[model samples]
Target: MKNLMKVIDALLDGLKRVLVRFREAKLGLLFIINIFKIPDFISDKRVNIINKFRLIFALTIAIIYIVSGIDFIPEIIVGIFGFIDDMFVLVWSLGIVNEEIEKYKKIIKKNKDPKIIEDVDFHIRD
Candidate 1:
């Protein structure tokens, strides 16, 4: 019983941390909508060519997973549970892509160099 209580306490603490982080992010409930804007990120030439390719590839895989009608977890068999894996992939990929886009924009803002935008191969490393 004591071990169970400890486990429960740990779970609660983790939940609290997640809640706090979500609130701090200020992304709102509709933040997922922003993730769907892959084209917007791809259109921005300020982002490096490599990052753009990564975003495009990730988005293509996501689209295939969703539209192919056949996936590692078939929705016809498990209903909503089947979609969970695809959703997880999309959410994870979108988060990474969003971070890359933001980083690229910040670099452009900080440098304010027209040459930086033209130099698609160059990346400002920390």
Candidate 2:
């Protein structure tokens, strides 16, 4: 029936939106946790010089922009509305820092226990 089809379509759309929101919430939570780890990551020498430099520079700029009055959106006139740009830069930079930290962690893990060739059945290619 037409009514049944409409109901099915509505349900699917609602479900899709819910799934998207859930995914966003999950990523937000991860971002919050990783944001705190920025300091540790920056201090970690194993993260490689390039990654460390990038993380430090990104964080410095974000912090400065958030705290200084010379932002693209001045909070003085717009009140809390000004924080939009500050939050955007902070979140964006923190996201990059988190990604770098994750990459370094993965690299460290892989190097620590490399599974190059261990305990596997082998077959000669014919």
Candidate 3:
């Protein structure tokens, strides 16, 4: 019975990791899609119009997943599930930074503005 319990515990641990990875992927995709919608990168006024509506929907899901601790599978049952949530946030944060860098690069390329480019790099360094 003890050995059986050990096996069950191990399986639960693995399951938690898998579920967390699933959540992280969902969050990451949403973030990447949003990055393309930023005003500077997108010229079409229509694009902005579409994205504003999309943003609301995306933000709603993001808020629920982040602010509400209710997981599809309860975190208490599999401890690592919460860690997965943290990982998702970490990845999403990194994606935001990356998107900002790309945005600045585009700005620098378009205007050939040394001051703006320098300012962007300065913030990136700090």
lDDT (Cα atoms) of all candidates against the true structure: 0.66, 0.72, 0.54
Name the candidate, 2 or 3, with the larger lDDT value: 2
> What is the C-alpha lDDT profile of model 2 across 1-126, one tens digit per residue?
999999989967755664554444345667677667677676766678898888888788988887787987788899999887776676566666666767776876766545477789989998
Q: What is the per-residue lDDT of model 1 for residues 1-126, given as tens digits with 9 covering 90 to 100? A: 999999989967755664454454345444555555556667876668898888777778877877787776788899889986676556545555555655665765676755545636766989
Model 1, C-alpha of 19: deviation from truth (Å): 13
Candidate 2 matches the true fold with a TM-score of 0.58
Deviation in Å, model 1, residue 39 alpha carbon:
5.7
Query: Which run of 10 residues does model 1 get worst, by summed lDDT?
Result: 21-30
Q: Estimate each model's TM-score.
A: 0.55, 0.58, 0.35
For model 3, the run of ten residues with the poorest summed lDDT? 41-50
Judge candidate 2 at residue 38 and give its lDDT.
Answer: 70
Give every collision pair in model 1.
Answer: none
Candidates in descending lDDT order: 2, 1, 3
Looking at candidate 2, what is the lDDT of residue 112? 59
- For candidate 3, the lDDT comes to 0.54
Off by over 4 Å in 1: 1-46, 113-126
